[model samples]
Target: MYADPRRRPVTFFVGERVYLMMLMWKGVIWFGKRGKLAPRYIGPFSIGQLLNDQTVVLDLPAELFGIHDTFNVCYIHKCKVDDESQILSLQDLKVDMSKKLLEGPIRIVHRKVI
Candidate 1:
């Protein structure tokens, strides 16, 4: 089939780290931010197990405990060793003990009154 030649097969192994695509919802806030600036993917989460050829379970952190662990291959991207900039650090986040994110003070860089 013509599709076969163009399609590339993606495989993931257990213990391999991968990034999971974050699905944007109307009102839900992913991580500490939301809207257009929000990250498209989160985690370099380790693969806990492969459920099927297309599905795998991820070892998500406690903060993301509410989300389902299983994900399809299309929803994940293999983590590259040299791409440190693509990874987001959870320690950089200002989360309180109650699992709430603390809002930092925002300063306006530019202002014009029309």
Candidate 2:
């Protein structure tokens, strides 16, 4: 799949793991971490469900990545810097529509091997 107009998707094998993601409505910035705690959730979802004020709707588990129901914005970070595309960086986060939305980065931290 295309990773926007600039970045390309990393090569993956059949056994490789990937998370389904899309753009988020909110802005988030991430800093390199050293502590080891909590589950490592990923993605912004490829398909997003229409949100409502009364109740919250979510993307389908099977249709989307069924592994995780929700994700934290900080899970993904840009390793390299490029000309900004109206996207929100952790350094500068704002909840606006005109700005481009993107998925959280896939990260592997020191955790017990299952």
Candidate 3:
């Protein structure tokens, strides 16, 4: 009874695009280093098949061949259309050899004397 309100049904259809939750493992360089800024999910892959009501098979790329294609619905999220304004271009960013931002803020947006 307590969990009913918090629980929501999730559904997916074949050919629909969705994001898959990514798991980090020690010594797995394929997914890159895990850190505070590491990506939590990857891909907007198409649904290849439905194994059951709660399980799905994704059409993952060849690079992800090592990982199982099947995933539980809990680990999948529907992909929404991309927002143009929300996208950032890498060319606009200025980084040094170490990949740290080389430029500071152009102007302070707020300042307090207190």
Candidate 4:
């Protein structure tokens, strides 16, 4: 699960701003706001992609500069979004991220072009 900012990213770091995680597993989005921690899922890219690139094409966020320590999932705080969907959003997104990311039946579709 993404949006949680705690879920693993394809890449990430500490003290960074918002993240645009590309999910590779099926699960729930859990943020560390509640003083909880989990393995990262996607990445720690800077807010640049979401800020400059209209399509949210992120490689790595500039703010992810000084942090290093990264880990895989072990502990986490579940979010409101269901983990049975392909997308993780604050809205009504339903899909299995764990299954889809491991499976080959997923394709990424965005709302705009980069």
Candidate 5:
């Protein structure tokens, strides 16, 4: 017999600050990241509004301009800002036409016969 661990779902409120999880499949391509150097999260934007129980609007800064502000709870993560220096900033990123990440291959995985 095993006891089920207590699991509590996280929730975000209006005016709260949170970071958006950087999804690799979303087509984010960092300037110098080729393999393991790529970052996993992108922002600590503030919540603009609560669209619903599962969605929140973010106040993205000028650096992340031209992108949508609304995101689901799954894409948002809690940020621990103990000090101002703890904040992170992404210098540059590249995306495809759909605004998803477009990174090149890290190495040659397969080769064909001549």
Candidate 6:
């Protein structure tokens, strides 16, 4: 592997909430909707059980009804919400199936040419 043996290993436990990395090629809508601007992690879903140090079962929401809940450690990351973590409500942003985020309409406040 490209990783160093001296580095600490990634770990997770049962009952911990984590964000699942969006992988797999399910067309542009799921994987490359925004090209490189797409968010890497999807949810802070709670872990139902730890199958091992490398995999865990997640309590996925209804939104992901068709997708599997069990995921590998490489596909999940621990979500640590600190004081600097801003709480965003669903009403704050508009997201479509294509994963396109719409903050608001685009307006040209000023224009300049060099």
For all candidates in order, the CA lDDT equals 0.81, 0.35, 0.76, 0.35, 0.74, 0.73
TM-score each candidate.
0.68, 0.18, 0.67, 0.18, 0.62, 0.66
1-114 per-residue lDDT for model 4 (tens digits):
547866654332233333343233445444321222332533323333322212332344354444332323222122323333544433233337453323343466656868
Q: Report clash pairs, candidate 2.
A: 21-45, 21-46, 22-44, 22-45, 29-90, 76-104, 76-105
Off by over 4 Å in 3: 4-7, 27-30, 82-96, 101-114
* Superior candidate under lDDT, 2 versus 3: 3
Is candidate 1 or 6 superior in TM-score? Answer: 1
Q: 24-93 in candidate 2: lDDT tens per residue? A: 3233322322235212433322324323322223343463443344333223332232433433334333
Per-residue error at 1 for model 5, in Å? 14
TM-score of 4: 0.18
- Model 4 off-target regions past 4 Å? 1-16, 25-40, 50-54, 61-114
TM-score of 2: 0.18
**Candidate 1 segments whose C-alpha is farther than 4 A from its true place:** 1-4, 27-29, 82-90, 93-114
lDDT of 3 by residue, 1-114 (tens): 557887778888999888887667765534432587566767778899999999999998897787789999989988885653443333456767786777776557799998
Model 4 — which ten-residue stretch has the worst lDDT?
69-78
Measured on C-alpha atoms, candidate 6 has an lDDT of 0.73
lDDT (C-alpha) at residue 5 in model 2 = 78
RMSD, every candidate, angstroms = 9.4, 17.2, 7.0, 16.5, 12.9, 7.9
Question: How do the residues 1-114 of candidate 5 rate in per-residue lDDT, one tens digit apiece?
Answer: 486578677788888878887666546545345456676667778899998889999998776675688999999888878575656455434666785776766458699999
List of clashing residue pairs for candidate 6: none
Ranking by lDDT: 1, 3, 5, 6, 4, 2
**Per-candidate clashes, comma-separated:** 0, 7, 0, 30, 4, 0
lDDT of 6 by residue, 59-82 (tens): 987766778888888888888875
